[model samples]
Target: MTLFVALAVLAAVVSFVCSIVVWKLGLRFKLYPQIRERDVHTRPTPRLGGIAIFIGILAAFGAAWLVSSLGPDRFSLLTIVFENPAQVLSILGAALMIVLLGVADDLWDLDWMTKLAGQFIAAGLVAWQGVSIVSLPIGGISVGSSWMSAVVTVFAIVLVMNAVNFIDGLDGLVAGVTLIANGVFFIYTYLLVQQTSPFNYFNLASLIAVVLVGALAGFLPINWHPAKMFMGDAGALLVGLLMATSAIAVTGQINPAAAGIEDLFAAFIPIILPFAVLVIPLLDFGLAVLRRLRAGKSPFSADRKHLHHRLLDMGHSHLHAVLIFYAWTAVVAVGCLLTYVLPVYLGTSARWALLFIGVGFVVCAVITLAPLGRRKRLTVAAEEAPAAELPGVDELAGVPETHGPVTAEAAPVESPEPPNGAR
Candidate 1:
């Protein structure tokens, strides 16, 4: 346990250093993006943040490999029956491949279909590794089926990839949120591993999550508000894929019932944890698709209609909007933790916690909707205003009467009657 934790910490440090190097490289290579209409930032920012994160993940893996090779008794236990470490390598490899795909898209503005194809292929590779959902459990009840697991896993991977991608709107938004999500996963999986028997490979999953969190933390300094660099599609997609893979690996390997909770729906619980952590993005994805379809537009078309965009429109600044999302993600993530820790008999606590979550959601909703509500009221008031009392363009124009000639203050107001005459 100590060795694993140390490796994770080392990986984070390496990842941070890698981020700094990458930032320098970006500046020297001139790999910067221009300000676009949809962009939230005002200045040109360098990219290639993905390189740093990738290096960090690789550095962590190298340590893991070295440990396995040196201490055959300790690390070799990892290889004895589960083949978990190798599976982690495969998953990481898929993430790296997707990162490359993202980099290509970032640099070249790759076509939407092309990007989608790349994402699907990346997901396929991970799915191919046989780290798929294999059953459905309702609370503590198991409805085991291999085919259902496969479908669910594929769907989850694809959803998570897009979810993280969709929410990568502001500087440090995706990176920060991802780090938090992964951190939660790491803690949960670690605890699970500690409580379970030796055969449990939960530790490896947590290790991956920890390494990812470290990499993102390292990159955050460069990617925060008034960012000097952006992670581009490469970083966003890579983060998403790793998160998705980690969730599956952790949940698939553990039985929730082992925690002494009698899950009436055991299979559903594993799936729910990841979903809760990612609720904001996944919900936003559904909204995006529905909105695009309603507008008679391509579902894949990019636009400023995301949840963050709506928040910005409602008067939150970029950082505020990002933080708003961070708060919500934290809330949901903590809720997940509590659900896991507290047994079913303490159902009342979970219910009250959920009620609080609902209130939080309502506050966000009101903030989002209140401005439009005010606008509507203002419009209605304007229509009902007495025209005689309301100042008109002619009345406010400050033009002197022609018969009286120009007053010293007005000088006949020669500026085309101020067009429409309303002030």
Candidate 2:
């Protein structure tokens, strides 16, 4: 308990400080990006936010190690870092690979293939550390084939890394969603730690989950709407990789005796909950790929047809669109979290809680997306005058047009996806 609280605070503070430091560095180095056609923001903002996040993770882990080694007795909670060095090294190594790749992309705008090579290499490193899936649990059957499991595990990691990169379109979208998903995963994994048999090893998954939540929480304020900094591909991929690793750890490492046959739902929860936590982004990834491929374009192509883009086209402000996406993400992840979380400790009564929360989420969605009729902006003079006093359409036509956004289109229908994940 003491270790977890201390770790969370340390990680959050380090990440927050890193964001500020990186913001300063970005300005000095001119690492931010200018406004582009497919971009949502109107102003240039820093793009090296991921640098701080990566540094924060390292600082937090170092602090944890120092604390566990120096603290007299009560701080043994983090001793797992010292005891199981392999797990800690594996995750950090993989994370470093993605962070460096992000930095390269931010600086030089690496081609998609180059960045992808980095992703596969990173995923492979983690798999080499015995972090890959070894089996699939469904009903009473245990599907085990070493080669197939390894392939599946690495592919799952890479798929999520790309999915998260795709959904990093709006300000604070990926950060907020990552926070919610990691928070739920943290709670679920912590509960599993409590329920495991006496001989179960340390819960590295829970630690990774909490560290991710802390890092993302610190990043969110700076990355919020009307943002000062964008996380670019670096932060997006790092968080996504963290999420995938945490899921793999919990699902792959559970002992068979602990997940016995009696509880069918319990047995299935390990396999289902990880993916359920990321349902929205995964769904969007699939849809986006299909939409692009059908248009005779590469699956990596970009368009303004993303869900948030549609919301903006409907006249919702930038902040509103981001909030709507946040609400929808919370609805799915939190709802799934509750279903499993409530049932474990509360038994059948968990179903009622699930029903209530599920309905509440639906209500929130309906209200968020309620019919908001288009409202015309009224000038002060127009608001004060009657219909007879209003100017005619010809009077509006007489107003001279200034140099502004172009409505003219030519060549390709959709904007090509930016190489740096800037769009």
Candidate 3:
């Protein structure tokens, strides 16, 4: 745990410095593209933040290698990397590939098919190096064949990457949501390791999650509301790829029977938690695809009708919409985590966790729909209120009406432009 924390801190420091440097360089070089019609932000911003995130992750891995070489113990924090050097290298190589693909798309606006092909290639590369899902925790079901496992893994990675990228419509939405999701997942993976491998808790999944959490933490200061730069396609897809990798690394490695997880819900948590954390992104992705298909457009075509866009259209302030995403992500991810936590640590039933999830869902739903109620009330009030008499031309020409001078409170406040340009 101490070593993990150290690596995370290192990643965060490096990422923070890199983000500032990147933002400055981007601005100096005029690297950003013109604001598109579908964008939510008003100003043009750079989209090369992914390069910093990838560099930060690389630095952490390099530090891990250094520690493994010089530290007293051989298998201290590099257990996974030492034992499976090929796999670790493959994951990094795949990540680099993804970053390049994203950068190209960010700069050149690569076609959907070309980007899709690149995603599959990167996913396939990682799967080939043993990151593929070999089994499920439910009833200890294993993949029938290696080919099947690779196929499933590739598909899952692509799905998650696109799902995550699809929701990068709002500033800080992806970074903050991914940070919260990975933070919970890091805890879950850490606890699971304590139970499954008590003596050696250093594993690939937790390492990836922690590193990602740190990277996002460092990048988020600049990526927040009124962002200085966007993560672009590269950063979003890289997040999805790594997050999917972390989930796959741990989720399939555990066997319910071997791990002594007899409770049905507990057994399924390995499968459930990943999707639970990603519920919003997946939901948005699914809806977007369906919407485009129904409209006779490409599934990967860009649009302004995403869930975040609706929140803006529904009158949610920029910050409020981003926070709503953060809130729901925390509620769902933590709630699912609790189901596993209560049973393992407290020996309590999962009913408590289920209740928490139910209540959270209701609260989030109401908050999400609150704008509708406010709009309805305003509509009713407008209908019931008597119309005011129009002032004469003289009054409009700065002459005082018989009603007297207009008070500051009575003056109409001009609404500012909606913060909706970042993508």
* Alpha carbon lDDT of each predicted model: 0.70, 0.73, 0.87
User: Can you give the TM-score per candidate against the true fold?
Assistant: 0.79, 0.82, 0.92
Q: Residue 203 of candidate 1: its Cα lDDT?
A: 54
Model 3 weakest 10-residue run by lDDT: 390-399
| Candidate with the greatest lDDT versus the true structure | 3
Q: List, residue by residue over 1-423, the lDDT tens digit for candidate 2.
A: 456656777778888888988888888888875666787666667878787788777877787777778763755555754676776788899999999999888777788779888998998888887777766554224345766767778898999898888788788888888888888778877777777633332477887888888888888888886667888889999988988988887784344455433334455556677677677678888998899999998776667677667666655666776777677667766766665566566665445545765786787666555534322333444566799776544333333333334465533234323222235
Candidate 1 Cα lDDT to native: 0.70
Find the 10 residues in a row with the least total lDDT in model 1: 414-423
Q: Which stretches of candidate 2 lie over 4 Å from their true place?
A: 70-77, 139-143, 197-202, 252-263, 371-422
lDDT of candidate 3 over 1-423, digit per residue (tens): 888899889988998899999999999999888888888888879999899899999999888877877754765656555578899899999999999999899887999999999999999999999998898875558887999999999999999999999999888999999999999999999998898778778888999999999988989888887888889899999999999999999875455665453355766776788888999999999999999999999999999899999998886889989999999999999998998888879988878988998999899999999988877766666567676744443443334544556677677434466574456
Q: Lowest-lDDT window of 10 residues in candidate 2?
A: 412-421
Candidates arranged by TM-score, highest first: 3, 2, 1
Candidate 3: TM-score?
Answer: 0.92
Candidate 1 per-residue lDDT, tens place, 1-423, comes to 566567667777887788777778877887765656676665556667887788888887777766666665666654432355556656777888888887877777788888888877777777677777554432333325766666667778878988888887777888888888888777777665665554645355676788888778878877787676777788878888888887776565444454343432322445676788889888888998899999998777788778877776665666677777787787777666655544443544455555666777777667556656765665666578897555344433333335544567755646431100000
